[model samples]
Target: MKEITIYLFLLFAGVITAQTGSGEYSIKNVDENTENSDFGASFYGEKMIVFASPKKGVSLVNEVWEENGQRFLELYSANITDNGELYNVRSLKGDVNTKYHEADATFSKDGKTVYFTRNNYYNKKLAKDKNQWNNLAMFKATVNENGEWVNIIPMPFNNVSYSVGHPALSPDGRTLYFISDMPGSLGKTDIYKVSIEEGGYGEPVNLGDKINSPSKEFSPYIDGDVIYFSSDRPGGFGKLDVYASKTDGSVFEPVLLNQPINSNADDFTFIINPNTRTGFFSSNRSGGKGDDDIYSFIEIKPVEFKCAQMITGIVRDKNTNMVINDANIILKDVEGNPIENLTVNNDGTFELHVLCETPYTIVGEKSGYNPQSKTFTTSNEAGKITKLTVLLGTGEIVENEIKPEGLPKELPEEIVKVRPSTYVVNIEPIYFELNSSYLTKEAKRELDKVVDLMNRYPNMIIESGSHTDSRGIEGYNLWLSDRRAKSTVNYIVNKGIDPTRITGKGYGESQLVNQCSDGVKCTEAEHAKNRRTEFVIIKM
Candidate 1:
């Protein structure tokens, strides 16, 4: 019923803003070109990566494209000195860069990997065949032991559908969110997410109507607890504007940049200088040499704060103990505020940083299995690093028989149109030991359905509710039910859904779809049906 706010990235060229107070943005032009243009910037601490002039002598090739009447730009990278000067700007060499068009470079949190978008024709018969027309797929390169990047590969998420580009890696390097105009999109392009699995990529999920519009939104960045992206939606300082949004335990809403920060020109593709709190973005406004130029700004800093007690770890199966890909992992405070949401890779590992000296709940889950949730208190502060391990069980026994009622029959018109195009994540149920909450093989079978659901709705919120038969004492049953429900939620949340979206509720034999009571002889099938875990969409 209410219109959902979305963000669209607009490409422009200009510079705006002056440093406030004593804060100074160490500004530098990564590329020096008086006759050409360069932009689309990304940062990894001090090092910088971007795209720039593709003219002869400046680039390895000598070819360009004129969109409206001019040539499209190329990609480049540079290093930032300690004093903030950028130099050694050069075109990306090797087989990755053709003479067509390339831009938007991103680095992994550990700075060991790089991902960027390229547009043009390449002769990759196996890889580039998906989108032959607009072969704008994403590619990656990893830092080798010799300190040089090697072995570039195309991201698996790209296909023959629409174009995919503008990839941004999460601070933990476990999640990657990018833009695509694939078959399922609310607008010209939509933001999508996929897990970094064992050096590969899992399936991609659309970020939903909240972050995408009928216009266009691109260049996403995930820092701390907020997501920053570019858009040309209404009420902007220019043809394209920058916006910020926070994870409010549910969906997100666009928060426009304050006055003076956004101009009436084209401003888009921005990155924050992590070390200095300064902002670096690109624009196509006046005073620039060509179509676009890079700019820097100083952000208004709040009261100073530093993180403590950083928790990091790996997720694996209890038996056979292999890394489970795309497992949801979550860290939350006692009040249910999500501290971090992480998804494990095919290698079954994750990392999280937070202010310590408090208590926390760590949870993990995958499809076709039961969740694994545990509690651990942090005595370390932000700087203190802690490592932990989590194990999950597959719920194979109960998955085949357990089937809930159908989904809501009535659907909104807009939802119906987009819903079919969206992914449907399915997690199987968790099998408990006979008459016990302890997890078993059957439990994991059911949990897999939950993982599928999460993959389907990257922006939707979920609530995990636990139920039980009327067999034990009211108090005991309530506690057991709570544990069961929490256990289910923990498995997937730990796999990496926002813990805030998932809260466990234990009815303790309060609500029953069937009649089975305490101390009464009942068929195993009847009790099995009563012992259940369910999830609901709280926000779209």
Candidate 2:
């Protein structure tokens, strides 16, 4: 009866199918799953991946459910190796673990609070409704001073007549989405969201018809503007197919994830970090060590955004700090193909409406001023104004030559010539520490000079280009340098500089000024020369 109750109560937990595909994604099964039923994987902090299993894991107490001849599910986290292997798997500490079911955990941004799915059992007792049927309930816990999760409590919405489990939280932690067969559900089980507020949980809001089918919709995971879930709806490749619905508050159409990721089995609980385009999902497709397994996927091709957006730009003189009425602005795609030509008004502002998720560059040129270009990317979101500021009439400065008197005098030769018109801030080549994107103290101090320079030159706009010495693989260096670029931009933005005034790009080993290309024997100093932060003066 306990095993039967647990399986039925796990309304959303199930299997997924798998088939091979082209370059869009590459999928591989991980060692997180055991011979028993292991599923419900979520990233727990930086170094650990947490999930649930019907095996005695972290807690020493493993209570088997006689009906299935297997132990009930418990939350277990394992260390993730650099090469993406699982190690040192252990059950989660604290009263959160129980003889009943505990799974589908989501962590808050601060990592202070955790919410998970557990059987109605709590406090050493089983909770059954009027018919003696044990249902699933959502519970919350917090880490004590000793780092153990204590203070376990069921969510206020938990009820005896209905089951609520498979919890997923928004990154902000303000909205909690979970699967339930509670009152007013559209199907046997539907995904519902409630506002997580200061006082208590807000009223549960149904995700509505767009996402909920008459069959079922469960295992909801939010990644940026998209909501991922699985359903046995009509037009899918398997019994359950994972679908991505473009959601920005209101729901859009649900697009099924294609072959390789979804097969004729049950695929659900998809989670991803959009920035890295790498994530984990669960599937029971064939060739697994268990009934269901967690698989890691890497997106070789990014999902395209179809939403339209408005991009605007304002052109001004870098030296005079005045709007240029005769400025010419050309919008080009990431590949440098011209898409739209904008005519600047006498007021110096131009606007272009285009689709989101594609990177564009705005080139501003005037008869007297040197032509300049500013690059930016649009989003899949709505009502956002992607704007750019073009500063013209600033002549290119020679490396180690044009030193503003206001700059710190100790660094007189503070520039490096990257290109004809591009100058890189040569305060230090290695702006970030080794193997890390975090800005160092010296990097911050040098960036302080940039904040001051921008403050002095109101129309001044700069582009931060992060570089890497040819030591690591191409993909890794590109990712690391991109992180470095964003980190530097964030620091300056936090210092009260307008985000629009600064931009960032990563040139991983592609723009090396020295002979330290990959496989080339070079000293640490020579490599450091190639691994430098390029603070290029886009305007002024």
Candidate 3:
């Protein structure tokens, strides 16, 4: 008999909103946020987002919940922008927006089915159990071509005796994840999941002790096999904090998210699009305009949650064997995407707290020197220090001709210099369309040359760095360039090339061939040189 108290938000809904309490990333409230609580954001379709709020944008319902004096929560839908902002706020269409409380919803992959949370209001009346308790329940609905939720039906698993709400569907739309306070719950609430289909539902299974702490756990969101939820358990920032767990069969090991995502106040209802690495979460942290506010953020770095280690590496000049503290360092994953990039420490040494059992590459770059790279793999053991070194050197550009044994026959035999002692096949320049990351047909044609070359040389490794002209916002240009590099690398990987043999990153507008500075007058042809993508042979 858990009572709806202040900690539980008086039955308003699952977790919501965030503030820049620590400011590691950019986060702002949704456009429709008001003085009342606004939280529980979920994607309804490709271009729309549906969330729970009391703003009452276009709904006719006027009833207020006696439990808290706030208007009953209603589901609202809005257009999502390319930058993850919200607009065109309106009440969701259809009879699903009832007079009773409605919050926390999840949609199927095809955008046709939705599972939502509400009070156990059935038969046009409130349904209570023998204990005179109004339990929370979940409902199923279908979306019509008109964008309205139709065919509303109570889920078969709903029971008047216990509460079940905060629904999230699995990425494959095969299982439904949710929070409940059923008979065997470990706390006031626990996350549960069950196989679901149009025919019926399977028995709910508790997520287990790892995710279900003795304290309350709610607001579950699933992306692939990973689950994100909010809990008021021990060892958090303070009060409720968002936690993530990777599921291995029925077992899970939950890890607490870092600050800025979790603050001293309540933070929950976390959701993310893995492709773009952008997400939204809810929080009641201070500095927000309302009781709770939804926040949108871009992931500057991905959080790793495996065995940990402290990796130390040094950058130096290959010829002089002297430390180079001012050199730029780029850390890459096995697949060759930049994981972290920065200048090494003043001591010429850089340390990274990284995941164990992973392969990594470190690239050292200096203005006057040719780029150099070193690759290493972390051990499975934790708390050990490993050493790696990168040395950069330059050589005179030579016009001599040399044909490597495994080189493609079509490539010109003319050789350009490579890091003091190598000459390799050249890949044509890869360019992109304006403000776009998709690979143009010409870019693919050039990439195929590199792919064929790699297939011929199994020992060779390459790095593709994409650049953008200094035409748009600097930050946006960087993000766009990263996308372009990723697309190019992905295309090669899809064609038989091993992902570990290639890595890439976007340099954005940082490296321009000419002095096409932002404030300077420059021709489109000159700027176009800055938009080119370069694929350098890192190892051969």
Candidate 4:
């Protein structure tokens, strides 16, 4: 009994979010017929695609070759309308179709040269392997002056003992990629490429460990630097799954395309038109019209990074309802570490980036107005911006106190007494690295001033608030901000201040002083303005 190889794949399963361009794909059967297995589609001319099918037709039906108990595959063409609908299905004309199997074809850019896979047959004789099974081979044919595919010649690498099929050409037509179980293969069936030159072909080079596993890997389709193929290696959703790998020269890293592109059955032959982002792939999964059927897909518009979550808002007076220009605003994460500090614009508006799914606090203050703070949280949705309005009560300006020098002209020193003894000190923004809460040397230097203040006023109690830019996952940013806030408090405690006198909280990207919310593009400097650390007076 011939042992049938069952190719299965183990894959990482997770909920596909909108950001990875996952949910936008809509798949449907492409003019499928119930009787035969139809698959392996490649672009043919302007409005048609060529594929292989084993269904009975008018041309000729010879002896049946029972490999999978199906008739020999033959090349067929179908017209695709402007609306991406498939129609006018028929067998390819000329002498291309023969008694032996013929399928898996690729065309040159000019559509003159066609390379395809077929059973090894020369002069009405079948080439067989040691097991009495016919081995597959590749052939090339060019359009002759008579408008027919003539002079069919076998590829130089074809052999009677082993199979070499599934031809794919590089964009420049200088390289041919194919699958073979011939000598020097790392897997049962591996994808290999040979350099195509003017004379013939160069050495067949294995794609190496990056693309091939101990299992089967075939059906390679190249579009620019990205190569889409089918593999049965571990970590897939089914027996076979479609995968994509990007190549920088000779290096490749395969990434599995999760469902609905892949299913729990054999899925292969993925080809796409890069310009339209529309393509076709074949699968034998249930619900198809036949054993194997072609499915079409179109990419949804506006692919976005799911991590880009932000918050933006403005500050206004309590009664006047007017935008507060140049008002000092501080943002903090849930753990109470300062994330950013900014002053409202001349129009009483400010924008700050914040992380998603995190709680934050926005504090707005002026020298004479009553200091105000509001706490809110962000959501997990990408490209979502949270808006806010801060109302501060009017108050009288007090006598002079020592102010930090070289502060931005827009941000003046604010001294608001919380009690007869304690006063709020509005400090400069404290910055951290992207996606990091670890304190930098600059951060240490800035915190040193807070240490000095705590030491000078031994009875003072302070709250450290941390904030982050809206460039990462909200929950993660909140956690990072919490760490940052605690790090700040720890620094002060290490400076001989009692730990009980200081507390830290992280306020994620719930408050923005400007329009730098999710889906809004901002510069690094602008995002830097949102990541800040602040110290607020609690008691004295």
Q: Model 2: per-residue lDDT, tens digit, 1-540? A: 443243663344333344332226778888767777777778777667788887563534347776556777888988877656688988899889877778889988777899998888787878788778788888999998887899998999999788888888886678899988888989888889999888999999898876887887878898744688878776777677778775553223466777677877777777776556777788888898887788878877644333465656677788887888877788898999998776799899887776645687777888977998766665433334555667787632111234323344343354555432345565655455567888778888888888877787777678787888789877678778878888889999999999988987676766666677777899887777766676876565
- Give the C-alpha miss distance for residue 322 in model 3, angstroms: 63
Better-scoring candidate (TM-score), 1 or 2: 2
**Per-prediction backbone clash count:** 89, 10, 7, 41
Instruction: Give each model's whole-structure lDDT.
Output: 0.61, 0.74, 0.75, 0.72
The full ranking of all candidates by lDDT, starting with the best, is: 3, 2, 4, 1
Candidate 4 stretches greater than 4 Å from native:
1-24, 58-62, 249-252, 301-540
Q: After superposition, how far is residue 403 of candidate 2 from its true place, in Å?
A: 55
- What lDDT score goes with residue 247 in model 2? 52
Name the candidate that leads on TM-score. Answer: 2
lDDT of 4: 0.72
Q: By TM-score, how accurate is candidate 3?
A: 0.55
lDDT for residue 73 in candidate 4, whole number 0-100: 76
Q: Flag regions of model 3 displaced more than 4 Å.
A: 1-24, 55-62, 249-252, 308-540
Please report the candidate that would top lDDT against the real structure: 3
Clashes of 4: 41
Model 2 spans with C-alpha error above 4 angstroms: 2-6, 9-23, 57-62, 249-251, 305-540
Over the full model, what C-alpha lDDT does candidate 2 score relative to the true structure? 0.74
